[model samples]
Target chain A: MSKPFLSIENMTQTFPDGQGGTLTVFEDATFGIDKGEFVCILGHSGCGKSTIMNILAGLAEPTSGVVKMDGFEVSGPSLDRGVVFQNYSLLPWLSTLKNVTFGVKARYPDWSKAKVEAHAREYLAMVGLEGDVVHRKPSQLSGGMRQRVSIARAFANHPKLLLLDEPFGALDALTRGTIQDELLKIWGGTEQTVFMITHDIDEAILLADRILLMTNGPFARVAESVEITIPRPRNRTDIVEHPNYYAIRNHLVQFLGQRSKELAGQQSGGEPQSPTRVVIDKTGPAPDPEPTTKPQLRAVND
Target chain B: MLDNLSTNQRAAVLSVVMLVVGLLIWEAAIPAQKAASELTEYERLTGGGAPKAGVPPPSQVLAKAWEQLSNPFYDAGPNDKGIGIQIGYSIYRVLTGYILAALIAIPLGFLIGMSQVAYKAFNPFIQVLRPISPLAWMPLALFIIQDSEASAIFVIFICSIWPMLINTAFGVAGVRQDWVNVARTHELNGIKTAFMVILPAAAPTIITGMRISIGIAWLVIVAAEMLVGGTGIGYYVWNEWNNLDLTSVIFSILMIGVVGMLLDSAFGFLQRAVTYAE
Candidate 1:
């Protein structure tokens, strides 16, 4: 089979548990993401979602295995992979315009002063940060606006892989809803490949083309790849009304609330643990393709 | 009427009231001098009527201020240099030594802040040396440098260096890792990262250090010039004491205060410039 644009093979990470023993966070985990795909990884805390994101960003290394993008092995952080951290990590000292321009200039150093500025302003405008608002520092901005600038900064670079580690985690639900809509607006046109970690099931469904569900850790692994069957141009209000939305969400909710823990720490015997492929479509006549999962559900039912 | 005034205007009114009250008391406290006509000829020749040698009243000091300020740069001899020239010399020494200290301390502090090993290695020396008085180095400095002027500068340099070095290291070391990670993901080189991310993040802290250093430098220069004893405001004050010119001493003391306040406010402006709310 042809390799996907980005692939992880047998990734494992362990830390000395400070008692002269090792604690394995995750092991023999594997996955692949095709170009232009929006993938979200969902798990309860401590399932090593962030560790996986870090490894992909080149900010960290796993104890074993490798991550390759575009036919080459990933190493230390590069401009190609941009991250929007949970804390909104906008440089507090710079104005809104300069923060975006700071990244644009670094990514395109050869661009002229005016061109760099115009490019930055273009992206800033995309996030609704124009006029006097761009001149204010991050500290001067509200939490939602700062995140918008951070989003602007990340998107302006047009990175090969954009990583969002719960970028809206710090904002209130109201503000979160607004930025999510704004994010959807910007992301629709960019077709940027995204890998995000989210705790919100509704959010995972709202934004992701596919949700990669992780089993609970110490031997946690990517357990299932669940595709969102609802057609796109999806909105927060409209998506919940779709027949397939709840079908996909319920399957995810069951796996997370039950199977994730039941399946935790079961190191599969001597093989890479690729997630099972799942497709849920209640819109039409019942058609389940993966017969292997039927008995597993039966066992859980019993 | 007071209720109608703004806060700053109210404060200004209070300050003027306090000044008038204090100056009136000062002017009233001196004993009255007997007229020359009332004194015996022997008392006159023997100078029993010499002006009382005590704290000069504000009026006398004011008059002296007008005289001295009118030709502040005039130079006749070492003992009689103008207030402006004397103040100019002191400022020159302070700034020279301060700037020298900054040129070395800032970069060194950046190095120490960036490296845990360097910070640990240098901590012992800084702890041991920082508390020793800058004046205590004078005898050693004088012997080695063999020039009083340079030794005085050296004193200012030593006194000013510690605060700057320590503060820079602290500020630089304390910069958030998030910012650094941002730099890395941007593919910024080491130089660019240091300039773009690390410097601005640490700047408020570093400028705080600089403000402290300048204050110390100003304080030390006065004492240092007193020890070296030739051509500064410190020396001028001492020289006036020797001449028993209480009025000039009082005036120069005020000038010292005025100059120090200016230096401090200059840094205050810089600190505000670099400060961010977060």
Candidate 2:
């Protein structure tokens, strides 16, 4: 296969456990995201999913390994990789227009004030916020609106990659669905590469082109990559009725519900092998056309 | 009349009524001074007929207050100026010292807050110097500076610095880590992040510190001026005391209260301006 647009090469993260011993968060986890691909990582809490995202965003460093985008090694934060934090991380003092403008101006310093503001307002309008609401501060907006502002800020930079850490995790279910639709619409038009971390199985299936399932940590690894076979223009309401939806959904739910904990306990003492690829049947539940071998597990050193 | 008043208005009316009642009681309590049978040598030397022990009646204070207010800007000499001039001198000293403290404290505070090394190195010195009274520095200031006015100003500087310095540091350090993360994700440099993100986030708290410093500065200036014996409101009060003129002293005390309130309210306005809901 040709080189992916973004490559995570054997990234490992460790922290001191405060007893003069190191705690491994994850070890030698490897993955790659192709250009313009929408990928979601699914893991239970404390599985080092955010740690991996942080490394990709260049907000943190792995214990050993490198993340390269295109040809250059990622070192620190850049406007090229925009992150949408779960907390909505809007600078509360500024209005929505100013908040988006702040990032746009930072990304394109040569752009005039009017041009920057117009660019920011365009993105804000794309997220369904316009008119007087764009002038309101984050505190004045509802939780959903604030997240939309964060999304606008991230997209306004026209980043090469978008990193979302459970962006809709804090919103109500109704609001989450609406924003998810809006997000899908935006992503469909732009074809931006997205790496989102979410534990919601259906959300991953609906939003990501490929869903990466991670085993539970301390020696956590990406166990498998499930390719969603659903067709485009999928609706949250109609997507569930699709023939392949339950097959993909059941496969993900089973891994998270049963296999994740089992794999956590099964590791014996060597390096973790990279995740295997699993292609779901598009028509209906059927035996795999090609048999894929399970990854070799090893004992973990404590 | 009381039915339409809000809680604050009712409270204000009660305060005036209480003041009137207290003044009435004071007026009735002191009997018209009896003719003096014998005067002590000290009393004769100072002033033969001045009331020695009784608190001055409210009527005499009111009359003195009116006289001072009518010609507040009069400058008779260095030792004797009108109430307005005395107040103006006191305000000038407090502002000069307070502003000097802010200039030094704010930038140092930002440095200490942002750098762990600076915080660790400077914290002990701040703690050591903070608790010493501003007036306790008056004698040293007077001896070293050899200028009473400068000493008083220095005393105000010393008293005001701690709150602003400590508050600013606290405010800066307490800025949300998520906001800093946002700055980092945006690739904002250290200077831009500090000025654009941290400063606004810490502003309300910094203003709180400034409000506190102004209050302490105002309080310290009075006692410092009293100690240094300069031409300020404090000196005016002291001079009136030497002549045993309780009415003028009482009037000046009221003036001091009014000026302190004005200073505090001015800072309160600034504090409100910078305050954000989130």
Candidate 3:
């Protein structure tokens, strides 16, 4: 296999409890993502998925680990990594256009005004927001609309990596589905690398090139990295009829169920010993399968 | 939705209804409202012989007001400054004092509010001086400044500071942590974050404090002018009282109420303009 684009090696993080005891969240966890890969991480409530994302983004520190992107170690957040948060973190005082353009202006201050506006408008329209709303403040927008603005803002800069921490978690089911479809469409066509955290099984299967599952914490580790076998441009409705869909879903369900049982037992003192080896299902074949057709990757603005 | 009624119309309707009701009560209380005055002036109106007193009815007050308004500046000659001049003078002083208080108070309050160390250092001094009355400052201001206008202005400045200062501090302190985090994520350092994010986020509270300060400023001005003896509406009321002209005194009091109402309404509009309601 070719060298991975982003790599996290032996990452561990701990915090002092202020009572002379230390709380360890992750321990020597290692993972790597290839260029333009879309990965979703699924975990239970205390799984430290967000903590891992924060460390990868350089917003938080791991006790011991190296996060390397394209062979360069990440010391802090940079324009190359754009993050979209769960609550649609659009600055309320700025108009939709300004919010979207904020990143562009900061990252490319030398760009012409027309260039900046065109760049921002392209992304905003890609996210399905009309130009009329470009001048309106975030407070004037609905929740879903605000989240779309956030997505537009994140994607406008054309970052090398997009990090989403349950970006649609606060939306209604219908809204979430619409957003999920939009996100898949945007990510699929662009070949943009995405790393997201979610608890929803359907969301993971629908969007991810691969899914990383984590065990529950005080000490969590990447339990498995399951590759979705369903073909490209995967439709949620059609994928259900695929031969391996149910089998993959059942495998994930059982894996999570067993982990939940283990976590419960450990909490209740019903089990003492730690599980020696974590099984991360890579689904079918071990390396990636060769493509038989010309990939139809399209940049969002185009 | 009643979109036909603009915000101004709604407020105007409510204000008009309140004013009418107040006028009716004043009319009804004419006898009682003037009872103290009528008791003393009974001998003169009754030709020094009777108990029946002559307390002017509400109609008589209006007649005098209308008579005065017909040629409002006849008493002032060609200078021709009607009640508007008195109002203008009072407004000028209030604007100067209130603006000075806001300019000084807001920054000071923000500093104290943002830093726990500054808050501890200044909190005691604020607590001690805040409760001291504007009238209490009048004598000291008069002696130090030795100018009636300056003294009255100083008194207003003292009276208005506490509310504005406290409100600014509260506003700055109450800024949402989420907003701060967003600012931090954008690489906005401390000063840029404070002015760009915190100030706007806390604007509503700061404006509310300014509203309270303006009200106090209006309240302080009347008393300050009365003590310092200036050419303000307060002094006009006092001058009328020395001549025993009860109607002019009543007229001046009405003017003060109207001016205060206008000042309050203007700030209310400003408050609504700056707020971005979540």
Question: Highest lDDT, which number?
Answer: 1
Query: Order of all candidates by DockQ, from best down to worst?
Result: 1, 2, 3
Residue A175's lDDT within candidate 3 is 86
Query: What does candidate 1 score on TM?
Result: 0.96
Q: What TM-score goes with each of the models?
A: 0.96, 0.92, 0.81
Give a tens-digit lDDT track for model 1, residues A88-192.
888888888999999999899999999999999999999888899999989989999999999999999999999999998889999999898888889999999
Q: Candidate 2, which segments miss by more than 4 Å at Cα?
A: A265-272, A284-302, B1-4, B34-53
DockQ of each candidate relative to the true complex = 0.79, 0.69, 0.29
lDDT of each: 0.91, 0.88, 0.78
Top model by TM-score, which number? 1
Q: Across residues A85-126, which tens digit of lDDT does each residue of candidate 3 receive?
A: 888878776789988887787668799999998999998888
Q: What does candidate 3's lDDT look like per residue over B20-88, in tens digits? A: 888788778765433444555655566543434445556666776676566544337422346656666
Q: Write the per-residue lDDT of candidate 2 for residues B1-278, one digit (tens) a residue.
A: 79998999999999999999999999998777644557667766767657656678889989999999999999988777999999999999999999999999999999988888999999999999999988889888989999999999999999899999999999999999889989998899989999999999999999999999999998887787777776899888888898788888889999999999999999899888878777
lDDT of 2: 0.88
In model 2, pairs of residues that clash are A267-A298, A267-A299, A268-A298, A268-A299, A268-A300, A269-A298, A269-A299
lDDT of 1 by residue, B92-203 (tens): 9998899999999999999999999999999999999999999999999999999999999999999999999999999999999989999999999989889989998899
> Alpha carbon lDDT of residue A57, candidate 2?
83
Classified by CAPRI criteria, candidate 1 counts as medium
